[model samples]
Target: MAKDDLVSIDGKVSSLSGGGVYYITLENGVDISAKLCGKMKKFKIKVVVGDRVTVGMSPYDPTHGLILHRHKF
Candidate 1:
């Protein structure tokens, strides 16, 4: 789906899995798996466990998403 069609939400990285997969816990207490998007990969942005991040996903699939942005605070 297109980027504009994605639903964005804020979450915290809970764990890192093999194969570049990250598990994030959303603000509402839901966990979802996500991966880095193209720009993030190209720029080599690092996301470790406990970092807050923004995830973008299709409304139809809430269990998976793209790690769009990392929040620094």
Candidate 2:
């Protein structure tokens, strides 16, 4: 999909679910279900609860997204 088609949001991981899924709470107070993207898995990046991350969401389905990047600081 084109980058323009996805909306990026900054959020903190709230919890983990079955099958390596994560629940993220967005800055604007929305909670979305997220999963690590392919690149993160390929690079062996680890994501845990309470971590800040960037998620790419689709407007049509704002309740779920792909965790595209993690913020370490």
Candidate 3:
């Protein structure tokens, strides 16, 4: 997947998965797996699945990419 094609969870952080994986449960209840970006990790911001986040990655592999940022709104 290309970095430009990635996306941020418009919804909120829902759950956490092993191996740095997170379950971002969108408003529609469709859960998506996302990992924390390098910057986020450096900042020490805990990312939950229900927490809204911005992601950057390739469309082919949304799972593999950078999480630019996340927010409650």
After superposition on all C-alphas, the RMSD of every candidate to the true structure, in Å, is 0.5, 1.1, 2.9
Tens digits of per-residue lDDT for model 1, 1-73:
8999999999999999999999999999999999999999999999999999999989998899999999999
The local distance difference test score of model 2 is: 0.93
True-structure lDDT of candidate 3:
0.63
Among these predictions, the greatest lDDT belongs to: 1
Residue lDDT tens for model 2, 1-73: 7756889999999999999899999999988899998889999999988999999999888998999999988
Model 3, C-alpha of 52: deviation from truth (Å): 2.1
**How far does residue 54 in candidate 2 sit from its true spot (Å)?**
0.3
Flag the better candidate by TM-score, 2 or 3. Answer: 2
Candidate 3 at 69: error in angstroms?
A: 1.0
TM-score for candidate 2, residues paired by index: 0.93
Ranking by lDDT: 1, 2, 3
Per-prediction TM-score, please?
A: 0.97, 0.93, 0.63
Kindly state the number of residue pairs that clash in model 2: 0
- Stretches of candidate 3 off by over 4 Å are 5-9, 27-29, 62-65
